[model samples]
Target: MKNILVLCTGNSCRSQMAHGFLNQQLGDQAAIYSAGIETHGLNPGAVATMQRAGLDITSHTSNHVDEYAGIDWDFIITVCDHAYENCPFIPAPNAQRLHHNFYDPSKFEGSEKDTRAAFDKARDEIKAYVTDFASTHF
Candidate 1:
């Protein structure tokens, strides 16, 4: 099975969401992992957002990219620009590098309704991207 890595600035939001979507879409075709340049713990908003979409990411943890240094990655996808630009060089020689700058819902400061909407928007965008990625790649 192929190994895919989803990366973000902090493993709290976008990368975690993409991990959930990719796992749902790819199934046994690929092994999906998510990490960050720095760990910020799992975001509660992210878990709740994914729950509404029928995907469970509550068991997921915030991991640093170094944790998987020994594995060979088939693809390394960055879900945010900060990660894409600041990520250290991962020694995945054969891995295809992909990037998308998803908005940070965590940065949204507003009412509860607006905050949820922000997370929902980010989740939908990530879902669409990962769905197409699964179809095209796997």
Candidate 2:
């Protein structure tokens, strides 16, 4: 099975959404994990966003990139520039690294509707990318 890791500044939002989408799309075809350069726990907005799309990430946990040091990954994807720029060295010798900055919904603090919209937009973006990634890679 392909081993894939989705990384971001925090394990809270984008990466978590990507992890859920990839896992939902790829199923048993891959082993998926999401981590952060610094763990910021899970984002409720992210969980709710995925739930609206019928994917639940409520059980997911925030993780440090160092946690998966032993796994030989097939892909290492960064969903934000912060993680991409500041990522710690990982021993995934054969992993293909991909980068895409997904908007952070938590940063949008205007109103509940606006925040939800941001999360929804990000969810759609992540889902599209993941569907294509799974189709091409898995």
Candidate 3:
């Protein structure tokens, strides 16, 4: 199976959402993994946002990019600017690198409803991107 990695500043929101959508879209066509330059644990907002769309991401974990080590990656997607700028060399010699600066709902300070709105927006954008990614790549 093709190996794909989705990365973000923290393995909490954007990358996690992307991971779930991609997994659903690609199914057995690829192996999807997500990690952060620095692990921030899974975001509850992200999980709840996705659950609303029928994808459960609660079982996903926050992981440092270093955990992937030397696996040959087919695609390396950075979902935030921080990760794109700070992540070190990925050992996949021919991996396709992609970047998308998705909004960080975790960085927002707001009431519960407002926070959920932010997460929902990010999740929608990520879903669109992943749907497109699956059609174009797979």
Candidate 4:
């Protein structure tokens, strides 16, 4: 199985969700993992969004990028633009890196409904990207 890594500023939100979705959708074809440039606890909104999509990430933990050093990856996808630009070396020499930026739902500030909607939108965008990527490249 190919190993894929997803990264973001915080392992809390976007990266976590992407990990959950890819693992679910790709099944045995890929082993997906996620980490952050810096550690932050998993965001509750992120957890909620994944649960709504029928993917459970409640057991997922926010992890630092250092945890992945020395591990070989087939692919390393950055789920946020900033993280993409700042990513460090991956052990896999032939690993294909992709920048697939997604809006950070945690940045949304508004009423509860609006916050939920923002999370949903971000979640859907990531899902769409995953679907397209899987169809074309996985």
Candidate 5:
């Protein structure tokens, strides 16, 4: 099974959503994990968005990228630009490093409903990317 790690700046939003999408899409065929350059616990907006999609990430806690040291991953994908810039070094040979920067929905300044819409949009984008990858390769 290919191991995939999703990374973001705070480990609270983008990376966590990517982890849920990958696990949901690929199931046991791919092992998935997520971390951040710095830990900031779970984002409430992120948890709410995932739960709305019928995925529960309540037990998922934020973690630093260093927590993944020595773990071999086939792919390391950064889901946000800040994470791409702050990524930790992974020593796995042949590991493919990729970046697909999605705007942080949490940074959107708007009404409550509007902010939720942004989160939903971001979640859908992640789902599309993951679905394509899983269907073709995993």
Candidate 6:
């Protein structure tokens, strides 16, 4: 199976969502993993948002990029500008690096409804992105 890694500033939101979507889209075609430059733990907003979409990410954990140093990744995807710009050099020389700046719903400050909307929007965008990525590359 191909090894795919989704990255973000914190493994809490965008990357987590993408990880869920990738797992669903690629199924047995690839091994999907998500990590961050720094671990912020799993975001509850992300978990709830994904749960609404019928993807349970509650079991996922926030991980530092260094954790997977030994594995050869087939693809490395950054879901936030911060992670993409500040990401350290990964040794997976042959890995295809892809990037998308997804909004951080965890950073949105608003009423509960608006915050939920933000999470939903990010989740949908991530779902669409991973769907396309999986179809094109897997």
Top-TM-score structure, candidate number: 1
Write down the RMSD of all candidates, one decimal each. 0.5, 0.8, 0.8, 1.0, 1.0, 0.7
Estimate, for each residue in 1-138, the C-alpha lDDT of model 4 and write its tens digit.
Answer: 988889999899999988988988899999888999988999999999999999999999999898988778888899998888877766788788888889999999999999999999999999988888788777
Q: Alpha carbon lDDT of residue 20, candidate 5?
A: 94
- Angstrom error of the Cα, residue 126, model 3: value is 0.4
lDDT of each residue in 1-138, candidate 6, tens digit only:
999999999898899999999888889999999999999999999999999999998889899999999899999999999999999999998899999999899999999999999999999999989888977996
RMSD of 5: 1.0
TM-scores for candidates 1 onward, in order: 0.99, 0.97, 0.97, 0.96, 0.95, 0.98
Task: For model 5, name the residue pairs that clash.
Answer: none
**Backbone clashes per model, in order?**
0, 0, 0, 0, 0, 0
Candidate 3 lDDT over 10-34, as tens digits, reads 8998999999999999999999999
Query: lDDT for every model?
Result: 0.95, 0.91, 0.93, 0.90, 0.89, 0.93
Model 3 segments beyond 4 Å from truth?
none
Clashing pairs in 2: none
- Can you write out model 2's per-residue Cα lDDT over 19-137, one digit (the tens) per residue? 99888888898999999999999989999999999988889999999988899999999999999999988877899999998888888878888889998998999899998998887
For model 6, what is the error of residue 47's alpha carbon versus the real structure, in angstroms, after optimal superposition? Answer: 0.4
What is the TM-score of candidate 4?
0.96
Alpha carbon lDDT of residue 77, candidate 2? 97
Model 2 CA lDDT for position 36: 96
